[model samples]
Target: MKRPYKKTDLPVWQVRKFLEPGPIVLVSSHWQGKNNIMAMGWHTVLEFSPSLLGCMITSANHSFDMVRKSGECVINIPTADMIDTIIAIGNSHGPRVNKFTRFGLTPEPAATVKAPLIRECYANIECRLADRRLVDKYNFFIFEVLKAQAATYPAYPKTVHYRGEGVFMVSGKNIAMPEKFRKGNL
Candidate 1:
């Protein structure tokens, strides 16, 4: 029999911490020809065919307005070396500051979207908004990946992952399962 659900004895935050870490993506959006970027830790892959979905931005963020209006964004995955730049952009308000200019970051034109990609980042995933209702109440934006580009960093293949408020961890090691398990045999 299944055990009863109990909240009184469990630490909910600890349970959330158990999830597999994902990359720290810098989501760029353009509005009225002006561009902006903000670091986001809440993003995921939700589809394969035509590629789609999942990004979360607080309702109060300025980037939220830009993204909603433009319907396009570029997700740039930075490296471990970009921690300082990521923290700076994540902590500041775009309305009051031009992060790209202030941080000495370079922006490269994206092929399919108005939003530009951060040149220093390791990877760029250009996307168009697939759904905005996701952001209406949950602060999440679902998008369809239109294009992707990666820097020539063969040594460090993965992107950075934000641990919490100010802590971040890099992709450390890789482990592959046996072919039997890979095919659901084990």
Candidate 2:
């Protein structure tokens, strides 16, 4: 009785917009002893064992080139207070402007990767490039999380999610369904 699903052609921009908000990741990469940070909204956990994560960086971004050359990156998860800084970094080009200096963000040496970590962020993950072919065709990069740590946070701290363009939303309230409606309701 269910309607048959149909595939429809859509532009990449449209497809990107249709997807829900994703976690904001501050990706740091180093090359030639110079470091750079880029605000990325497209990232996700790919595996548990060995802690794998996937991220997408536009081919045109300066950070992409650094990652390609260094084969390492740090994924920093910032709290709500960092929304402004994140937006500023995302809106500007790293080659033209040093985001760390412009935003007054500290660049601390990562324990496992050549890239640095955002000191202001609540959490950070040091990763090495596990796969690069994904970037060749889709501008996506896969990383194997080598180490991770967290700063002090409340039981529930507000996190920012990028909605697109210059828009962002904070982590909202939580909801729990009744046991009957949770699973196997039918």
Candidate 3:
């Protein structure tokens, strides 16, 4: 058996460092002939059915208004190899530069949404605004996925997860424990 672990006090705001769900995603938006991409890490899967995703995009961010006005965006999942591009998009201002052109990312026309998809990314999820009840208070947007596509060769992409304070964790080896799960659970 493993030894018991010690616990330490942590600030409330810093709790996200330990509880951030899933990997960072590139949110692409287009409105009034302008396109923008923003790197987002504060997102969570809200439901399996209807494929709901909840993310917080501060009003100060340039892409927030674009996404809000358009009512749609593409959530692109980049591999660990695109860390530089991800950081560049996050650091740069959307109004000043075109991220797709600046970063050399291909923008493919999406099927359901007006926002273009990032072709270089491992996967892309086209989403439509589903709820705005929390946006006014929390800057949170709830999206309903309209379509999703991904590469088939690699079963899992090397995704990057943020741990706050400029720290990131890359996806490592995956373990399949199908036997440990009940039917329809895996």
By TM-score, the best candidate is: 3
Better of 1 and 2 by lDDT: 2
TM-score, one value per model: 0.86, 0.83, 0.96
Q: lDDT at 176 for candidate 1? A: 63
- Sort by lDDT, best first: what order? 3, 2, 1
Question: Which residue runs does candidate 1 get wrong by more than 4 Å?
Answer: 1-10, 155-158, 181-186
lDDT tens digits, residue span 33-148, model 3: 88899999999989999899999999999988998889999999999999999999999999899888999999999999989999999999999999989988999999999999
Off by over 4 Å in 2: 1-12, 176-186
Winner by lDDT: 3
Our tally of clashes for model 1 stands at 0
* Residue lDDT tens for model 1, 113-136: 999998888788999998887678
What TM-score does candidate 2 reach?
A: 0.83
